[model samples]
Target chain A: LAKTTQPISMDSYEGQEVNITCSHNNIATNDYITWYQQFPSQGPRFIIQGYKTKVTNEVASLFIPADRKSSTLSLPRVSLSDTAVYYCLVGIMDSSYKLIFGSGTRLLVRP
Target chain B: EPEVTQTPSHQVTQMGQEVILRCVPISNHLYFYWYRQILGQKVEFLVSFYNNEISEKSEIFDDQFSVERPDGSNFTLKIRSTKLEDSAMYFCASSEEDISGELFFGEGSRLTVL
Candidate 1:
């Protein structure tokens, strides 16, 4: 498992685009970067995932560089409901898919 | 969208008492997992189950903790004897083979040990 680092907190206004970046310098070739959003009292929800380049979904987008050492989660047209803790995980598809979590970035989308 | 569901959204138990958290994962999913989060702390993985057995578990999953897929639809986590430190929010998750690493989590069961 590769360790990840992200901002402790970020503030964004509604209708603005928010980008949260995570760094994993030791990311392996087989490792995939995944982002999860967690709201208060709720479980973590998968937002987006990517190996390299960019991956987009109905909810968010993920961008990875050539080095694969870092990734960013972009949320477009944020709303207050989007305020949550965003976790960045790096993992491989091993026999067991256990996700290691860190002190994710707490994104606050203000109205 | 199919989602994971957990029972007894909140549970309160006395120290040394046995407690069970129940979960019903997505119908088509094959893998199940349990995670816990202490107040104001990061979420921690506890165990993963597949093929009617535990595939992996973390150090936090001590001898007192156990998981069982008793039926076709229900997966359960049982703590033999609860302790104060065991009080936390326990989340149940599932993922399919096609999207192995993409997990769908439940709302979580908040356990309080007194």
Candidate 2:
């Protein structure tokens, strides 16, 4: 499993866009980048995943540069309710048995 | 939007007692997993189950820990004898058979061991 690093915490005002980046310099060839959001006392929900380049969903967008060593999760017009801890994981999709989670980025969307 | 579901949102147990956590994964999901998070700590994987047996397990899953898919719809984790140190939030997750590793997590079960 590749290790990931992200900001410990961040603050954003309501209605503003937020971008959180993750670095995984040793990401493996079969690794797929995935992001998850977890509200207090709730489960971590899958936000987006990508192999390379970019991937977008109804909730968020993921941008990966050619290096594939890093990626960013972009949330548009975030609201106070969007405040949550965000986790970035890199592993083989549908192929790996192990998934390691780091301390995650605590995003505070202040109103 | 089928989601994974876990029962007993909260559990308070005494040390040396047995406890079982239950989960009902998405109907179509084929791989199941268990993870635990102590207060203010990172999430840790305990075990993964596939094809009627364990696919992988972390060191944290010890001899006292066991997992079973007793029925088609229910997955369970049983701790033979709980310890105070076992206090933590336990989460269950599942994914499609293809192994894309995009696991969908259930709202954890908070286990409070005293």
Candidate 3:
């Protein structure tokens, strides 16, 4: 398991882009970067995942640099409904792998 | 979209009582997991199950905790003795495959141990 660091909170307004960065300096070669989102009283939902470079999906994009020490989750045109806690996890993708979540970054999408 | 489902959206129990939480994973999924979150705290992994057995479990999953797949569609977690510290939201999740697949989580079963 790779320890991850992220901002405690971030503020954003509707229609603006939000980028949350996570630092995993000790990430291993087999580790993949995954991001999950959790709304109030809801289970965490998978947003995006990437091994390197960039990966885009219907909801968000993940950008990982070559060094793999850090990654960013970019949400385009944020809305009030997007307010949630974002968790960044780094781990091996194996049968025995389990996600260890940290205190996630709370994104406050203001009206 | 296929989603995981959990029973007894919320449960309140006395200390030292036994409790069982049930889940119905996605139809095609092969991996199942249990995670808990204390109020205002990070999500913690409890255990993962595959091929009818446990593949991994965290230290939080002590002797008091157990998991079972009684049939084809249902998965369950049992707490033999509940403590006040056991109060938290327990989430059940499943994945189509064990390697590089996204997990689908349920709404969660909130346990309040008194």
Candidate 4:
């Protein structure tokens, strides 16, 4: 299991692009990077995932450099509704060893 | 979009009482997991089940906690004897093979032990 480090919180206005970075210096060769979003009173939701380089979807983009020591999650356009905690996880198959979570970055999308 | 579902959105139990939390994961998912989050704290993994057996568990998953896939679709977490410290939001999640580590979690069952 690779531990990740991210900012405690970030504030952004609606309609702006927000990029949050997570550092995992000990990322393993087989580990995949994934991001999750959690809203108050609800369970965490899958946001996006990637292995290397960059991957994009309708909601966000993930950019991983060659070092694989850090990755960034980019939310194209922010909205008040997007305010939530974002978690970055690094693991491979059978992550059951432990799916530990840390104090994720609380992203506040101000309207 | 299929999703995992949990029953008894909230449960209140007396100390030493037995309690069961229920979950119905996505139909096609093969792996099941249970996690808990105390108030204002990070989520902690409890256990993971597959092939009708526990594949992994955390230290917090003591003897008092057990998971069972009693039927084809229902996965449950049973607490033998509840303690006040057991009060927390319990979440159930599932994923397809390779997991993607992308667990689809349910709304969660808030348990309050008094």
In model 2, state the lDDT of residue B25: 92
Reference interface contacts recovered per candidate: 0.60, 0.67, 0.60, 0.67
lDDT of 1 at B10: 99
lDDT of 4 by residue, A1-111 (tens): 446688999999999999999888766666678889999889999899998999999999999999888889999989999999998876522344555554588999988
Q: Name the 10 consecutive residues with the lowest summed lDDT in model 3 chain B.
A: B95-104
| Model 2: per-residue Cα lDDT over A1-111, one tens digit each | 346689999999999999999887776677688898888788888889998998998989999999898889999999989989998866522334466665589999888
* lDDT score, candidate 2: 0.87
User: Mind sharing the TM-score for model 1?
Assistant: 0.91
On lDDT, who's better, 2 or 3? 3
Greater TM-score among 1 and 3 belongs to 3
Task: Give the per-residue lDDT of model 3 (tens digit) for A1-111.
Answer: 446688999999999999999887776567678899999899999999898999999999999999998899999999999999999866533334556665599999989
Task: Please give the distance, in angstroms, between residue B11's alpha carbon in candidate 1 and its true position after superposition.
Answer: 0.4
Tens digits of per-residue lDDT, candidate 2, B1-114, equal 899999899999999999999999999889999999888776778999998899888879999999999999999999999999999999999999434659999999999999
Task: Give the per-residue lDDT of model 4 (tens digit) for B1-114.
Answer: 899999899999999999999999999999999999898777777988899999888879999999999999999999999999999999999988543677889999999999
Q: What share of the true interface contacts does candidate 3 keep?
A: 0.60
Better of 3 and 4 by TM-score: 3
Question: Quick one: best DockQ, which candidate?
Answer: 4
Model 4: colliding residue pairs? none
lDDT of 3 by residue, B66-113 (tens): 999999999999999999999999999998766554788999999999
TM-score (C-alpha, index-matched) for candidate 4: 0.91
Candidate 1 reaches a DockQ of 0.57
